[model samples]
Target: MALSSSSEIVRRPHPLEAAIGDTRVLLDVEQGLYFGLNGIATSIWQRLEQPVRVSDLCCSLKAEYEGEAARIEAEVLAFLALLDARKLIEIRA
Candidate 1:
């Protein structure tokens, strides 16, 4: 499903998750899939500790990173799309 700036992101309840240095490891017990997150993804995951809107995430990241707003929004949306496709996150319109 396509995500818009207003879409809210929430982490799905998974079996396990761990933070190893700058990376985050997540496990889907029933699906038996292991996922790893690094760099900005790790930050994204941390932000998802609470449900947040895609636009808000982009705004915060844009302020923290040296990048164009459009670029940051596109990348954040793409990353959230991946997490959503993996069933690791839920996107609420």
Candidate 2:
């Protein structure tokens, strides 16, 4: 799939609490569930603090991870797809 821009994710502190270390932790008050993220996933979330395109995200991941760009891009797309499937993120035109 082609990369697309995504809407900004505004995290509310009231119902969401998160902590990051070796892995990132996300606690959702409404669901009473905690979500964890691997290193690359956590990095992607960190960069998505504002509106950013999928292509840009892949670029950043490659630059920071020192990994193969194409592989990292694919992984990034997959991660983004997972979040999109969960309605955790909004895709913008």
Candidate 3:
């Protein structure tokens, strides 16, 4: 499975990026790409320091975004899938 916490790796922005950026924080860094993010994405990205389960991500979505949790979960998952397709994130194993 590609949902292991370790390979789902995330890193906090060190110094400069951390100092100024809140929503723009580095969620995942690879292949010379930097995905600037906002809102639940910012929340989820920060929490993804370890390989996180989809349910865990949904929890964060619930906490961050308003409206139905299930609705937010679907939206968040879809966005995550888009990111995955972009090679921005990978399923951890």
Candidate 4:
């Protein structure tokens, strides 16, 4: 899925999430698959507990880490795409 900063994201309802150390884990009940996320990816997952704009995610991540806006935006979009592909997240324009 093609995504931009303006896109909004929300976690899918069927996944159960848990945190272990610095990593976050998700179980997709229907698919019986496990997904793991670390570091900033975990942060992004946590933020998606509610529907949020990708731009807001970028801003929050930027404040937590030192990086260019464009770079952070790109990485966040990429990670979101991965989760979306796995049916773990819903993306809306």
Candidate 5:
């Protein structure tokens, strides 16, 4: 499912996470899979602790990072799509 700017998203509670240097590692016990996040991805994951609109997330990321609005939104949507595909996050209508 493609997520729009207004889509609300939140992280699932199952993944166990750990911080290693500038990266964040996530272990999904049931799936027996592990994922590693870079610094920017880690920031996005941290923000997903609660439900938030995709546009709002992009806005915050744009403010925190030096990037074009369109570029940031595009990257965020792509990243969120990956998380959604992995069942690591819930997308609400």
Candidate 6:
């Protein structure tokens, strides 16, 4: 599903995760698939432990990372879209 700035998102409970150094590894038990997250992605995943608005998530990332707000928001939206595609997150309208 396409997500807007007002969308509220949270991680799905099914993916088992493990932190390895600065990155994170996720295992989808039902699918027997594994996914890896880099530093920035890991940060976003951590925040998704609880439900948060897309705009709020972008704002938090903008505060922590050195980047233009528009670029950060675009990247975050893209990443969230990928997670949504993988069924790793739940989105509430």
Overall local distance difference test of candidate 4: 0.88
lDDT of 6 at 6: 88
Q: Give TM-scores for every candidate, taking all chains together and pairing residue i with residue i.
A: 0.92, 0.73, 0.61, 0.92, 0.95, 0.94
Give all candidates' CA lDDT scores: 0.88, 0.66, 0.58, 0.88, 0.92, 0.91
The alpha-carbon deviation from the true structure for residue 92 of candidate 5, after best TM-score superposition, in angstroms, is 0.6
Identify the runs in model 6 with alpha carbons over 4 angstroms from their true place.
none
Which residue pairs come into collision in candidate 4?
none
* Model 1 per-residue lDDT tens digits across residues 33-90: 9999999888888899899999999999888889999999989988988988889998
With a 3 Å backbone cut-off (N, CA, C), the pairs that clash in candidate 6 are none
Candidate 5 segments whose C-alpha is farther than 4 A from its true place: none
Going through the candidates in the order shown, the clash numbers are 0, 0, 4, 0, 0, 0
- Name the top lDDT candidate: 5
Model 1 TM-score relative to the real fold:
0.92
How far is 1's C-alpha from truth in model 5 (Å)? 4.4
**TM-score of model 2 vs. true structure:** 0.73
Model 4, residue 8: distance off in Å is 0.9
Best by TM-score: 5
lDDT of 3 by residue, 1-93 (tens): 243222343333331234235556443433455566776666766676676777777766677567787687667667666666656555754
Model 5 C-alpha lDDT per residue in residues 1-93, reported as the tens digit of each score:
559999999898879999888879999999999999998999999999889999999999988999999999999999999999999999988
Using TM-score as the measure, name the better of candidate 4 and candidate 6. Answer: 6
- lDDT order of candidates, best first? 5, 6, 1, 4, 2, 3
| Candidate 6 weakest lDDT stretch, 10 residues | 14-23
